[model samples]
Target: MKNIFSPIEQIDNLDAKVIAGIERLATLFKSSLQDTAKRYKLTPLQAQLLIFIAEHSTKLCSVTMLAKEFSVTKATASDSLKTLVNKSYIEKVYNPDDARAFSFVIVDIAKPMVNELTHFGLLMSSSLSSLNENELIQLCHLNLKMLNIFSQSGLITCRMCYSCQYYQQKNGGFYCHLMKKELPAKALRLDCPEHLKSS
Candidate 1:
């Protein structure tokens, strides 16, 4: 009997190779990130958050929201947030909408640190010069698709790049308008870690 709803073979041998290559890419990036982060005294998670905040400086972000987005416990997020706050990397903001809530804005002084991470993308692109544009495009498409699949499957919850937010480009990249005054990149989070979501 013919199977009416059999699954199709989407990933073939070549696809497997591509997947392997993607895994290699991730490993290499992670390794490099760890080394770079160690030199700068930051963890991979911190680097990710720093980049996010630097790129989205204009927007407001909360530790609770960050915890949920990163699939981390609120306590973990708060702990990490506290470290950043103490280090003068991220500042906290109070919410006018709800005094009980707070938001985090990145400091411009940390731009140099953020730029270090950006350099990785440049390095990778230059190293993979042999790969044609179309191939690179295909790889990006597939990788994004795979990420979506994982996120949808509950492997991850969020996949947003803070830099891609709307507010970052505004306010000269510091203290999103939500804050009463222009706070430094590492102003101070309110007692609470809840506030409005920013771009």
Candidate 2:
């Protein structure tokens, strides 16, 4: 029952439904992640920052680095880190190479919270643990193709519209660099199905 359609034709036929489903799935993921983050008393950005920091456990991070990574102003990054520090979740250490910059460290008091985040991620991973080797590999490949198409579509979201730090500093508040309009201070999202993270 093999059809004589060209590769691109086959792709075009599958593209619309698959892309729409993937985008919807991403929306679901965001909602679920938001719920999980709330359980830990973390804002979406805070949770994302924590995850990024934990992933780069081998390297010391800086406010400037985070600002660049998240497409936020250095002042915004400093304030977010300050909030975490005040909560005793993270600590700032003086950098030997640069006196003006400080390195980040996870405070011992936050291990439980951090560990819970890990546990939640693992729980989600385990939801797919039933898939055997081939299925998992195939799924990975499918996701890669989906992401490739999504990236090529040129509809990804901008960070300026997504970070809380960006909005607080602007006079109008909640500025969307892409839209040039005032956005909801809390959401900080592009209201799009497909968005990109600078990091």
Candidate 3:
């Protein structure tokens, strides 16, 4: 029996080692988010929803999009949104494109809490800061490539530049035709408001 959690020396396969490393990082993120959520008296999902609504555009903050983004059922997402609304952390704005639909927006009163909630990723960012600039760029590229593969397989939905129709690979670099700008490897976005699925 092979265990990826075994000592580094015991895991000879590089791919398994990488998976183990990612598992460890996932553990760290979960713990951090849980701790923050507890401090604010919010469920992990509610805290996550609040933080995501603060960061993303309103159009992407609806129950349907939130369900897809968080891999939760629409009912679960809607319930969480209701909790946030009750807590006065978010408000529903009628969608202009669809009057029957409403999207969420963080309320002014929750700005401070959202600022604190966003700190959940601070430690991970600090850890990555130890790498050289080139290494950071390379790591970003690798992560985007891996995310694209997962998105293509329908394992998860990602609104990333690499999967957007406007994304272009030119002269061994990246360009966004919609933005009409060259994207440095480090500037590749994991989420963009204007992302459109590529055919």
Cα misplacement distance, residue 17 of candidate 2 (Å): 3.0
Q: Over the stretch 1-199, how does candidate 3's per-residue lDDT look in tens digits?
A: 3776778544577777777788988888888888888887898889889989998898789999999888899999999899899988899999787889999999999999888877867867988877999998898889989889989998788999999999999889999999899988888988888899999
**How high is the lDDT of residue 79 in model 2?**
82
**Top candidate (lDDT):** 3
Q: What is residue 110's positional error in candidate 3, in angstroms?
A: 0.9
Best by TM-score: 3
Clashes of each: 6, 2, 0
What pairs collide in candidate 1?
91-187, 92-188, 92-189, 102-194, 106-185, 107-185
Q: Tens digit of lDDT per residue, candidate 1, span 1-199?
A: 2232222332344555655666678898888777777777888878777776666433336886677666788898888888888899888888788888888888778788778866777887798899887777666555555664665566765432222122233366434344434534333232222343233
> Against the unseen true structure, what C-alpha lDDT does each candidate score?
0.63, 0.61, 0.88
Return the TM-score for candidate 3, rounded to 2 decimals.
Answer: 0.91
RMSD of each: 11.6, 16.1, 2.0
Q: Looking at model 3, how many pairs of residues clash?
A: 0
TM-score of each: 0.65, 0.57, 0.91
Q: What's the candidate order when arranged by decreasing lDDT?
A: 3, 1, 2
Screening candidate 3 with a backbone cut-off below 3 angstroms (N, C-alpha, C), the clashing residue pairs are none
**Candidate 1 runs further than 4 Å off:** 1-21, 57-60, 158-199
Per-residue error for 192 in candidate 1, Å, reads 27
The Cα error of candidate 2 at residue 141, in Å, is: 3.9
